[model samples]
Target: MNLNLRNAVISNVSGNTQAQLEDTIVDAIQSGEEKMLPGLGVLFEVIWQNADRKDKQEMLETLENGLKK
Candidate 1:
């Protein structure tokens, strides 16, 4: 079977409101389950794709800081 994770993830969350998305993200994180990683990665990919250069740099800096901890 040919599975497209990105498309699947996007379709799953497509119609969610801001609050819904926030709840989903928070719940996934608080669960701390490995199964949620792919969805989070897909969400981050969407964020990265839509971000401006400044925002991307800020994200990178945040990632760097996180890695330091």
Candidate 2:
């Protein structure tokens, strides 16, 4: 069977309120399961695509700092 993970992930979270979305992300992170990474990546992709230049820069800075630690 063919599966589209990114679309599936987006569909799963579609129409979620801010709090619901935040909880989903937090839960995924706290779970520390590799299976959740793709979903997180998809979410990040959506954010990155919509983010302004400043937001993208901040995200990159945060990621860089995180990797340096």
Candidate 3:
């Protein structure tokens, strides 16, 4: 069977509110499970695709700072 993980992940959270989305992300991070990575990657892909140059730059900078910790 072929599974489109990105589509599946996006569909699962399609209409979630901001607080709900935050809870989903926070819960996944707190769980620290490998299975959650794909979903997070899908979410990040959506963010990256929609981000403006300035937003992308800020994200990269924030990610760089996060890596320094």
lDDT of 3 by residue, 30-58 (tens): 99999898889889999999999999999
lDDT values of the candidates?
0.92, 0.94, 0.92
Better of 1 and 3 by TM-score: 3
Evaluated with lDDT, which candidate comes out highest?
2
lDDT of 1 by residue, 1-69 (tens): 114888898899999999999998999999999989998999998999999999999999999999999
Cα displacement (Å) at residue 64, model 3: 0.6
- Order the numbered candidates by lDDT, best leading: 2, 1, 3
- Position 57, candidate 3: lDDT: 100
How close to the true structure is residue 21 of candidate 3, measured as C-alpha lDDT?
96
Better of 1 and 3 by lDDT: 1
**Superposed Cα deviation of residue 30, candidate 3 (Å):** 0.3
Number of clashes in every candidate structure? 0, 0, 0
For candidate 2, give the lDDT: 0.94
Pairs that clash in candidate 2: none
